[model samples]
Target: MSPAFNLETCARPNILALEPYRCARDDYKDDGSNVLLDANENAYGPPLADAVSLTSAAADAGLDLLGLHRYPDPHQGDLKEQLCALRNTHAHTAQTLTPANLFVGVGSDEAVDALLRCFCVPGRDRILVCPPTYGMYGVSAQVNDVGLVKVPLTPAPEFGIDVPAVLAALDAAVAAPDYDVKVVYLCSPGNPTGAALRKDDIAAVLGHATFNGIVVVDEAYVDFVADQRTASLAEWVLEWPNLVVMQTLSKAFGMAGIRLGAAFCAAPVARLLNALKAPYNIASPTSTLARSVLGPAGLAAMQANRAKLVAQRERLIEALPQIPGVGRLRGGTDSNFLLYEMLNSSGEPDNAVALAVYTKLAEQRGVVVRFRGKEHGCLGCLRITVGTEDEVSRFLEALAKTLAEVRQ
Candidate 1:
C-alpha cells in the first residue's frame, strides 16, 4: 500500500500545504575531495575540537579539519552498519540493514521531526503522547500541524505509567471515527520522573499498535539505565513493523554537539522517512565523527560513562532523601536523570516547592536543572541530569543548604 494517507485529514496541515524544502543531489553525495560544491557550506577549516575531544570541559574543543569541503552520505551506510551491531537487531534476520532501513539526521531531535513529517498529515491527523515526558514530542507534532492527545503520567505512585489511561486514550481515538492513533510516543525512564516504563506496559502498547497502528519507543536516555540492554525496544521493531525505536548518540556517547541520531525500523518505514527527509539531512563531518564514535572503543567508553553515571545516580538516591523538605527522590531501574520532589511550605505535597528549590539552585548555587513542572506527574519536581562525582557533590551540598532554607 502506498503511504499516501490523507494529507489534510492527518496532522500538520501547514506542513502539507507548504512546498517542502529541497536539496540538490550534489548536496548529499560526497566524492571525497578538497573542494566542495553542494550546500554552500562555508569554505573554512573544521571546528576547534574533535567529536570526542569536544566533550571535555576545555573551552576550545573544536578542531579545524580540512575534510569540510565535501558532502555527507545521505544514506548513512557506515553508521547504520555499526548501529546494527550495537543494537543487536539485524535487518533481514541474517543481516543487511542497508541504506534503505536507516536515515540519519542532525540529531534524534531531527529524527523525531522527520518521523512527524513522514507519517503525520498535520491539522487533520492526531498523535497520542504521554506528558511529564519529552516536550519536543509535542513541539515536533505541532510543527507538523499534528494534533496532540495528551494522557499525562500519574504522579501519585511516584509518577507511575498510567497504562490503563493510555490504553483508554488509544481506544477513544480509534472509536472516534474522526481520529486514528497514528503514533504513540513513550519515553522509557521518562524525563523528570526518572522511571522506566514497565516492560509489560511496553509490550501491551506494542501489541496494540501492531494490531491497529504505530508506536515509537524513544530510548534516548536508555543508556543511563542500570540495565541498558533491556531499556530499549530496538530488537522488537524487527518483529513488529509498526514499531519505530528512536535513539541518539547525544546522551551516552556524549555527541550532542555533533547532532547525530538514528531511527531503526522496517525498510518500509525507513523508506517513508527517507522520502520525507531532506536529501542531505546529515552533515559530512557529522557522519565522520559518528563513524569514529560508534566503533568498539567509542561504544566501550559510552558503556563506561553509563556505568559511572549509574553509580552516581545510586549515590544520589541514598543521599538526597536524607535532606529535609525533599519529599522523595525517584530514579534507577531506568534513565540517568533524577526527579526530586520537595515538601510544600505547608508540609504537604507541592510541585511549587520543587520549582522554588530548582530556582534557588540555579540562582544561588549556580546549578542548572530542567524543571518538569506539575504537568507530567512531576508536580513539585526537579529533573537533574547526572554529572561527575565532583559535580554531584556540589549539587548535594547546595541542595542541602537550599532544603534547610526552604524548611525554615
Candidate 2:
C-alpha cells in the first residue's frame, strides 16, 4: 500500500529518537579553541604524566593524555569522520558514509543491544538468527528479554543462510497475533563456520516485501577477508535503508582490549542509535587510541599483519587434511579461523575423538581450540584461530600428536 519501507514504522513507538545529552566538552572539540571553563576541568592538567607509558603510535598522535580530567565528546565527531573516510574509500555504486552513518560503542555488542532496544518491544517483538553463527546475537536478545526465531544455516562446508526458511519464518510470524519479527542478525565470515555469505543472498533478504525489519551484518573479521574494500557490505547502508553493517577494531587493529566497535547504517538509523545511547559511551583513552590506529600507517601495519595471517591460514588448510585422523575442512577459506572435523575408525566424523583431541591438546599440551562439534552441521569439528608463525607451527605439531594419542 505504501511507497516503500520506513525504519520508524517498524521500530517501537515508545522508543523515540530524543536528542543526545549535550556535554560541555563537546563545544571545546577543537583543541585550544575555547577557554573550556564550562566543564570545570582542572586547568592545571595531570600531576603525574610519569605514571603513563605512551605507545609509539599514541605518542605520534599527540593526544592530550593529561586532559583526562574532562569528559569525552558524546558526538565522537572526529573519530567518526576518519571511519567514514575509511568506509568511503570502498564506495562505488553506493554513496559515501558520512559521520551520520556511524555509531561507536564498547565493542559491537553494544550496537547489537542498541538495535534490539531501539526497534523491538520486549515480549511483543522477536528477532531471527541464522544459527551456527555468533552466540552474542542470542545472548543480547535474551539480555533484552526479547524472543528469538532461529533458522539454521546450510549444512557443513557452506553454512550459508537458508533464505527461503528465513522469509517463510517472517511471513508466518506476521500472520500470528502477537509475534512481530523486528531484526535479523547474520555473521559474515561466520564465527565458527568461517564462511562469508554471498552478496546476492543478502540482497534477497533486503528486498523482501513482507518483512520490513532491519537486517544486521556483523563483519568482525572483515579485515581478514580477501579484497576487503570490495567484499564489505558497509557501503550498502546508502542503498539499503534496512541494513546495518557492524565492524570492530578488536580483530584486525589488534585492539581487542580497547573494546571499541562501529556500526554503519542509513543516516537516520545511525542518528536514532546515537540519540538512544549514553551521554558519553566512549572514553577518552579509547577514542585517542582509536584515532591513533585509524590513520594511514596503522592501516598499512594491519594489512601486513593480515598478509602473514592469510599465509599461515593457507599453510594450515593444506596441511590439516593430511593428518591421519583429520577429515576435510568444513567451512570456506575467508576468515582467520578454520573448522575441520576429526575422523573416527570408519572415517566418519566422530565427536568422541574431537572432544578427546580438544581436551588432550589443551590440558596436556597447552594448545586451545574451540570444540564446536555440537553446532549445527559441525559434527566432530574443532575451530582453530590463526596465530603467529611460531604459534601455528606449534599448534600443527601439537594437533598431530593429540590426534595420534586420541585415536590410539
Candidate 3:
C-alpha cells in the first residue's frame, strides 16, 4: 500500500501557497442578466463583420465572432462542464468530475510547466521523464529551471516504462541530500512511439510508498486508441489524488489552433493550477471554439473523423512493412501516428537512410514525417502521423519511392 499523499507537503513551500487573483468574471455570472462595468471591457461590442451575415454553415459548425473586446470567462465554467461530461461518459469511476476537478490551460504545456513550478523548486528539485516520450516534458523541466531525471522506456518493441528502475530511482532519492523528484511525467500513446503504457505499470509508480510526487499522465492522443474507454487512465485520477490526466482537442477534434488543454485532477490540485495561471489565459475565441467542438454535434463529428484515421493507420501498419527498405513497425499502434524503422542493405536499422528518406519526402515529394533517429532506442525511425486516405496513400507512395532511391 502507498503512503498517504498530501498536496500541501508536496508543493514548494513558498511558491505553491497562493491566493488566487479573483477577476470580475469570478465575482458574478455572465448569464445575460446583469452586464456591466466591472472588468474594464468595452461597452460597445466588437465592430461588426463587413457585409457578411451569419451563414447557416457558420451556425452549423458552431463558428462565430466572439466578443473580442471583453475578457474570456476566467473560470470557463461552461467549457469545463462540457469537458467533464464528455470524460465522465468514458470514465469507470462513480465519482463524476466537476469544474473544481479541472484546470484549463493554453495547452498541455502550460499545465506541465505549472506542475513543475508549483512542486519543484528550481535548481533544487527535479522531475522524472521516460525518454522516447514527449519532448515537451523535458523542455518544460528545463524552462522551469528544474533538473530532470531520465529513465528511458525499455527498448523498442514494447517501449514500456521500466517501473523497477523508476521505483529504485525514486526510493534512492527519498532521503538523499538534495534534488528530489517532484513529478513523474508520462505520455500515453507516447509522442513518437505511439505506444500506450500499461495501466499496472503506472499504478505501481503511483502506489510507490516512499515517493511522494505528482504523477502526470498525458493522454493527448488517448482518443486515437482503438478502445479509448479502456485505454485512458482518466478515471484513476478520482482514486489517486496525486494523478493528473491531461487531454486535448488537438488530436481527435482537429482543433489544434484553439490552444486549449485540460488537467483533470483532485480539486485542491486543480485549485492550485487555477490560482497559478494567468487571469485570462484562455482567450474568448479559444473558449468558444472549444465549446463548439466539445458539444454533442461536434463530438459526433470528431468520432466520425477518428474512425477514418484509425482505418488509415491500420492500413499503413499492414502495408508499410512490405516496402523493400522498411522494417518492423515499432511500438504500439495506440495513437494517430506510427513509429517504424528504415532498413539498410543487411536489413538492420539505418539512421542515414532514415534521414535521407525524411529529407527527400518533404523536400521533393511534399510529404512530411518526423525523423527521430536520434532518440534512445529509436534508431533509423520516422514518426508518421496517420492522415486522410489520400494523404496516407501519398505518404506510402512517396516513402517507397524515396527509400528505393536512398538505398540505391
Give the alpha carbon lDDT tens digit for every residue of 326-379 in model 1.
776644446777776778667665766677788899999999887665565556
Candidate 3 per-residue C-alpha lDDT over 1-408 given as tens digits, one digit per residue, 9 for 90 to 100:
347467878988765667888866676767877867887877876665552465334546555553467777778999999988888854557777888899999888788888888899888998999998888888888888898889999988899989999999898778788878889998997988888998889989999998888999999999988776676777668888899999987888898988999999988889888888888999877888899888888899999999999999889998998899999888788899999999988899999989999999999999989999999889999999999999998999999999999988
Q: Give me the displacement of residue 343 in model 3, in angstroms.
A: 0.9
RMSD of 2: 2.3
**Any runs in candidate 1 off by more than 4 Å, and if so which?**
1-64, 89-99, 154-161, 209-212, 331-333
lDDT (C-alpha) at residue 89 in model 1: 39
The Cα error of candidate 1 at residue 299, in Å, is 1.7
The TM-score ranking, best first, is 3, 2, 1
Best by lDDT: 3
The window of 10 residues in a row where model 2 has the poorest summed lDDT is: 51-60
lDDT of each: 0.71, 0.86, 0.86
Worst 10 residues of 1 by lDDT: 1-10
Residue-level error in angstroms, candidate 2, position 42: 5.3
Per-candidate TM equals 0.83, 0.94, 0.95
Q: What are the root-mean-square deviations of the candidates from the true structure over C-alphas?
A: 5.2, 2.3, 1.9
